[model samples]
Target: MGIALKIVLALVSVILTISILLQSSNSAGMSGSIGGGAEQLFGKRKSQGYDAILSKVSTVTAVLFIVLSLILVAIE
Candidate 1:
């Protein structure tokens, strides 16, 4: 049971890491500067489509990761 929990914990950690990485950065930095006023004039679209999906998935996985961590501690 302990080993199973540990394995689940590891898998959740990996998923959390990947989901975080998959998320797009809020600030465009250089690219935004280069693009200039376009973002302002056009206005930033709300995160939709793929980004929205990733955001939701990442959120779910993050919660799962925390739960799994707690479970791992309990098992130990």
Candidate 2:
């Protein structure tokens, strides 16, 4: 892939990684399901609510990841 695409994808991948890490997991026990984990300071609900930006970020990242993989394959 082009350098620009790689750079942008890298940056996006980093953000996506961070977003996913910050968000709670789907199967993180009752704490995750109930939004009552040890890290639940204010909000940070486990469920992907309407304002769950991480979910969107994750979706975009997943698409980007797939696209990048395809691009790499095509290049090879």
Candidate 3:
């Protein structure tokens, strides 16, 4: 059980990293850092197509990674 969990965790970690890397950057530079929050807050930026899918994938994988980590620790 422990070994299986470890393998799954490894896979999830890889997938999380890939999904994050595959997504397009929303900000350009220092200017974006300052105004990006306002744009997102006002719903000016919207995710579509591949970006949307990747965003959801990253979110779910991140949550799963956390849950799996906790479970693995508790079991040990």
Q: What's the CA RMSD for each of the models?
A: 2.9, 6.7, 2.6
Q: By TM-score, how accurate is candidate 2?
A: 0.57
Cα-based lDDT for every prediction: 0.82, 0.72, 0.93
**Model 2, residue 46: what's the lDDT?**
54
Model 2 stretches astray by more than 4 angstroms: 26-51
Model 3, 9-31: lDDT tens digits are: 99999999999999998776998
Q: Candidate 2 at 32: error in angstroms?
A: 8.1
| Top candidate when judged by TM-score against the true structure | 3
Worst 10 residues of 2 by lDDT: 42-51
Angstrom error of the Cα, residue 52, model 2: value is 1.6
Greater-TM-score candidate between 2 and 3: 3
Write down the TM-score for model 1.
0.72
Mark the regions of model 1 whose C-alpha exceeds 4 Å error after superposition. 30-43
What tens-digit string does per-residue lDDT give for candidate 2 at 2-76? 776777778878987887888764556865657655456565445657437778888888798779867866776
TM-score of each: 0.72, 0.57, 0.81
Counted clashes in each candidate structure: 0, 0, 0
lDDT accuracy of residue 29 in candidate 1? 90
